[model samples]
Target: MNYMDNKISFSAYSALFNNVDNCIFTRNKVSNQVKWINKDDNDLNIKIKNEKRLKRILFNEIKSLYNNRINRYNLEGFSRINDEKIKDLEINKFFLVEDKFKGTSGQYSVFPRTFYCDKCGDLRVFSNTDEWKHFDVKNCRNKNCNGKYKQFNYVTFCPHCGQIKNIYPKCETHGTKYLKLIKNTENQKYWKVKCTKCGEFIDLYYSFCNHKDIYNLNHSISNEKSSKVMLLPVMQNSIFRSVVKTIVDVQNLEWEDNVDSIMLGSYLGKFNYLFSSNDNVNNPERILEYITTVLKTFEPHKENPQKAIDLGIIGPNLPQIVSNIENTITEIKKNYFDEEFTELTDYLILKNYFGDNKGNKKFTEYIEIHDSFKREFEKLKNILKISEITYIPDIHLISSSIGTNRGVSTLEDNYLNHFEPHWKSKDKDIFKVYSYPFETEGIIFDLNKVEVVKWLIKNKFLNGDEFNQFMDEDEAKNIIMNLDKDGEAYSHLKILLHTFSHIMIRRSSLYTGLDVDSCGELLFPKSAAFLIYSTSNINIGGFSFVFENSMIDWFQDVQLDIKDCIFDPSCLDDNGACFSCLYLPEFVCGFFNGFLDRDVFLGKTDRYCVGFWSIDIN
Candidate 1:
């Protein structure tokens, strides 16, 4: 046979090297059953397993690659070896030998699995402490990956080439700090190098603290040198930066599982109230007066379309009703208050209802007598519809303070003490025309819905005899001292009746879950509104003043119509007295939420037995 034919084929050669049984069979020096090494044969084994000798060289090459010591000298040495011999050597020793090329001298294995360049071998470590700094790759530097590189210090280096790496963009908003590895040439311990574009040292845990030296490779940088980083704007507002960072992380949280929709809706409602609306424009204070006047005009015979012509009630024939309102406003100012419509329509409403007990009827019956009043209410509704607003406040917020905060004996005491002064009257004639009420505790107590109606019918001669016992001439005189000959008592009585009617209706409705049980005006405190609006669990029994305060914004200025200098005790609920019961203002502040579908908290829709009309202040 030719020598070329005797040469082994690639497969046969690999089989002989890789298969232990085949090696024993081909060599014939050992049996497959027991080819064990022995001390006796040590010197006689000079046949030098060619595979073992070649493996020694390959091991040195791998070690050099890890130390980053591969150079011209090593490459020349590798060239002297045969390819097949080297392959056989590597395969035999692969499992037993350490992969020096995959780990740094003092670090863990970088890519213990595979060390090929195409695999992009890298070393990564993580530490809550600063000990493992060098050899830590916190993030991929590759522009596209943007992957976080773990911080595994001297534990390992880039297995591919033993190169050091870094973690970058520690905080994206600040976009200033980057993490690099630092270690002494012969030292095992490592340090982190934070090179920040903003120049200030960012602490790892307390991320915004000044600690440049800890992150600086050389602590030799002077204070002035370090101060250079201070000039940056990014460095100046650290608190803002921290907040931004916190918000970013917080935004990533799972809020969907925690907060319910009702809470979200409430939060949005408050936010919108603060930022939205132009209701206060032109004359906010007067808006409530305008609305009140429009309501009072509906009191029987209070409206005189004839007066529209008599006073010329402002130049006739305006295209829109608002224009008519404007004219009436002009007439009220020109003919009444001095030609300038300064009284906002809202305030005008209150003034007209309280300022005059007109038409010789009990004030309670005034709105019922006036046909023009109905027309004005309709007009106000149309104006509100056009404006597309949620609420036309009947009351205005003039001033407010918590009773408890005033150092009073109690909240109740504070309210009573503070509002007592408004009970005093300046002119008896003005009082007589207004029929101001006695602010006395007992009288104020009787001013509620049931008692006021009794008073109204007695003055009207409707139920005169039966209610005569409750009516005292001296009390009526005290209340009527400052009044119209026909008397302002009725006007004063109407306002108290109207507003309290709402409170009464709302209170009754709140006790019972049913909505239709109550009628007339409704006072919906926030807690009641929340209960009414909720589709889930509701607990009205536990409701109290605190709950109301927490959920609703208080109505501010309110001018109450009272019958005498004595407090209209009728305004008091069973809950005891309040300063507001002593004297009522023209406009008051109250809270409103979207009430029932057809029933708005304070919007126009006279159909529901109760409605509110939006007045045009301009």
Candidate 2:
């Protein structure tokens, strides 16, 4: 056969066997022998030639057959094997079929193939197949029919009234020879029943007595049967409503599972949808009010300290839900986890000061303490470190009097400026000397000549000019001293230097301390003091001087005289001729009085310094 394999025809076999006859006898003589081409009749030669044509025809036919078989196999083979796949392909077919059916019919009724007699309550078999065998009853229940009840009949019924009025072939919906009085819940009295068929409540007291045992038809007593009615403990209004209102008022807020979050959870938009839409069956306000009433109602019950108490109207199983919400509310309130408080604290801590007042420093210290407490608060929140109260740091002002008794001040500039020109240094040692001289007569010179002469003079060993300069000042005052003998020019210079030194030391105190020891020298003792104080709280009063006992003792005497040790307002006063008001000459006496008078203070020790006036009363 000329079977097509990849579209290649196998025609070569026919070509090779075209001349080979069925009865061929061949003798091969290679060198001198004779060869017989055919041993059968010539008809066999004719058959051989025709066999090629036959084979060609058969090959074409068989190839066409195989092709057809393969085509049909794939098309129908897969279709018959898998039902689901065939159904998917047939979906379009049903749409067309349904379209045709829909045009012809509105609706139809399907009747039972077999049924019991309505009047007699006897079962009959009107089954479609012979497998449903029928047996004869001794007496037929139908009073009118003379026909024996031996076989099942397919009866016809009226379409309008649902009666089996016709019998041989069949009918739909109606037709009956005798009346069948049905005992359903709707018609009978005394037995109260809810009809599953029509969802109508009926009392079946009258006609239903005959079938009472079959339906368990008693209605007078409570059965205590399981019925899914209403969900009890319907929610009411509450603080929960306020929380939810707050959450809905805000946006994109969510809270964790805790009392705080639960309380605040509503504010975080948990039930925002309710207020936006009035579709809720229960009034929103009333719902919250009811919930609040329920909670408050339960509050007293909790104090009774009994386990597993019944919650009557709310339902027995609602205690857990109520408790959970209560706890969550409590947790949220305890944390003060509100945006307003956080914002206020942030503003307070970060506020900046304007002037050079030390009050700003105290405010800055307050901010530091605030930040530290905030950190601790956050840590406690996350770790749940429970406490009745928390310790918070206080800030106090850096006093103006800190370090007054701590370090030393110098007297060189206060006492030595007048001697500066007449003084000399030999190998870093300064010394004072007196001179009276003439320029040529070294003691007598003009004031300008005397000033230049003094510039070149040495104190330890007076050069010629130093000797002349003092001689002029001595004589200028000598005529006046001869008028008033004790008048002194040197004393005025001493006072000017003293005021100069005091100004320099006071400026240093603005940075370090006022009682600066040896301002010109490198080695000097310095004192520093710090006081701590507290700010107002929601529940507690303010505080001051917050520190340990050791720290207080190290910097100050334990016995603090509240009155004298208090900050001095007048020390900053500069009205009269006290130390602060002193000019050049008076500055000397005031500075000396400030340094020398022990009465200016109480006694102090190396271990402790009494502040301001004294430890003992005047």
Q: Compared with the true structure, what per-residue lDDT tens digits does model 2 show for residues 1-618?
A: 111111211111111111111111111110010110112222211122122222222223223322343243222211122222211111000001124322311111111223343344333433344422333333455667443322222222111111121122221232222223233443222223333334444321222112111123352112222222211110111000000000000111122223123322343333333244745523323334444555655665565424435435344545665676666566545644333222222122211111112222232234356564445433332221111111123221110000011012224332211001111222212211111110000000011222212221221112353233336633432221111111232222222223323333323223322123212110000000111121111212222121111111211321222112222334322111133322222111223233221111222322113312222211
Once fitted onto the true fold, the runs of candidate 1 whose alpha carbons sit more than 4 angstroms away are 1-327, 333-457, 460-618
Query: How well is each residue in 486-510 modelled by candidate 1, as lDDT tens digits?
Result: 2334343433333433332233334
TM-score of candidate 2 versus the correct structure, residues matched by position: 0.12
Give lDDT: candidate 2, residue 367: 32
Give me the displacement of residue 267 in model 2, in angstroms: 2.4
lDDT score of model 1? 0.23
Off by over 4 Å in 2: 1-263, 271-290, 304-314, 330-618
Candidate 1 weakest ten by summed lDDT: 241-250
